[model samples]
Target: MNILGILRDGTGKMAVGASVAAFVAATCLAALPARADDVTWTMATHAGGHWLEHGAQGFADKVALYTEGRVKINVAQPGALGSPLTTTQTVKDGIAEAATTWGGHVQGIDKTGAIVGGWPGGLRPEEWFFWVYEDGGLDLIKQWRMEKFGVVSIPCDTGETEIFLHSHKPVRTIEDFKGLRVRTSGAWAEIAAKLGASTVVIPGDEAFSALERGVVDALEWAGPGQNFKSAFHTIAKYIITPGVHYASGLTECIINKDAWDKLSEHDKVMVEVAGRLNLYESYARYGELDIAGWAKLKEAAASGNNEFIKLDDSFIAAAQKASNDWADEQAGNNEWFKKVLESQRATLDKLETWDEFRLPIGGVRE
Candidate 1:
């Protein structure tokens, strides 16, 4: 009879009882007129910054506006609920109703997380969005979430290409990476390890202090704008260009499946529209901010305090090879990962010919 107690019980012995209780609760809630008028959800996020917070808050605002205040989402960032790595599970466990998170943080739970979140040598943001919107990627993501985490997820935001690394020493070549201590996560960490670097998986919040204290010799964060906001330039003199590890970032808005299913069809559609709007606005904002951040970095470089170095082509080629090998090994072990990778590669292959000619027309040259 006690709904919360049954839902919170850890033992599987109460599974049937809990299900019955949940169904009853849902039925009761649906009958209450006030329930429809006062729906609200809380979303947990990893860090607080323009790159993430703006989009998250924007989504919340749009959802509220679209639903005419019928539904509200409270955004909590800087790991208020838990670290980024744990937020997905928090949503899945019903401790939180929703989360705005990087998919890679949940890679341990589902390999598809890494692929959707942003894989090493992965598609660019536009290509990723194309795959998700037009090439069945969204359906695959939904299936993966339902099967792996008991959640529903949608792509809510896309981030620009990230800076490769912020380091105390220049990492110009593959050999230069040997013996370096780097802070990264998911497949990129695996690739870094293959390059003979010691890789540590630490929360983004801890990266600044870790690099400043010499705990990590190098680290990669979101991108130029975010790094500038975090004052990474002050801590590391070398700013590496072209984030080969993760070409573009994808942030997902995840909701517990039960919670999602409880929503009215109209409300559900509103949430989806809000997510799409957030995706567009977030990427555009990042572009504007990144340009401003780059100007500051250029100024610092001119002052001889900071230097931006492009990683050698040979090093990129080698890292790409390593990334491919890792992906192939993962595909051999996980069917879902294999499926997602195959889908992504197919999408990329189809785009390659178009890109070869399209990219050269008005592409910026150094």
Candidate 2:
């Protein structure tokens, strides 16, 4: 009683009570588990050996690392969960919590997907990376996916300049592309068709077999980094340079809305962070690999039957016009596509500021 009385002047008593309350709260917090959410979400990807699959595991690992075991990403076996073209559908269907897939593959569902996949005459890897994080590009992608697909979209993997075509014939003119049985996807397919080329939308995994079986005369897959070993060098007579179909490559992670909604804010952030980091890493890793891959292809060409066909500047100019025209047509058909394309173009336009400050005129032309 005396000890209580000693500390119990009304204000002192109030302070003592507050301290007791804080102690109880601290004890309750300490008793709780460390992870607010112990969620392990499954992510679908292309088959095992594919770059998308490689990046899927990398992103998953990064999420686990950032979340400190609170969140785990369960990456599925190659083609076991979804195909390159169907992974987004798998996520939308709730078969997988998320998928790492090219947005262009889903262009059949919505024309805008092609723009998100980094369309022809669009951003390069570095510019795309900058726009995604700094500008409102990421937010726009998230918005579009949620609004249209009922899923969450994260830009997980971004890299590669892309090989123009692994072809059995040389292509240096619009006439060269015309009537050519080529395998490609997304907006490029549409543009190629308009250019009079017969374009088949085959998944990358099947591209090699199709080329071998004469199902398609040529294919445009990743840059030399992956193309060198994709067996294209062995089968194709021509390795076209400066991917005019699409300058940069971008792949998205489509998350099931339910799964994403369940994650704690902290977990959500870690997931986004992991995807963002994966983009930068892929860009750097592939940049280096593509350089070496180019050398490898050249060396292989010296002995093997491969030939590097740099698309004529005039033809590239034609492709650019066609790409811009395709974008305009698609934009007219779909408002979402129009909006996003405008935003992207605006970003590219802003980069024109570099022109004013250029000490030398030696960089990317388009």
After superposing all C-alphas onto the true structure, candidate 1 shows an RMSD in angstroms of: 10.7
lDDT per residue as tens, model 2, 320-348: 99999989988887999999999899889
lDDT of each: 0.80, 0.78
What does candidate 1's lDDT look like per residue over 159-259, in tens digits?
88889999999999989999999999878988889989999999988999999999999999878888888998998999998899998877888898888
User: Which residue pairs clash within candidate 2?
Assistant: none
For candidate 2, the per-residue lDDT at 188 reads: 90
* Model 1 clash number: 0
Q: Would you list the clashing residue pairs of candidate 1?
A: none
- Model 1: lDDT equals 0.80
Candidate 1: stretches off by over 4 Å: 1-36, 356-366
Model 2 residue runs over 4 Å out of place are 1-34, 47-50, 355-366
Q: Residue 168 CA error for candidate 2 (Å)?
A: 0.8
CA shift at 265, candidate 2, in angstroms?
1.0
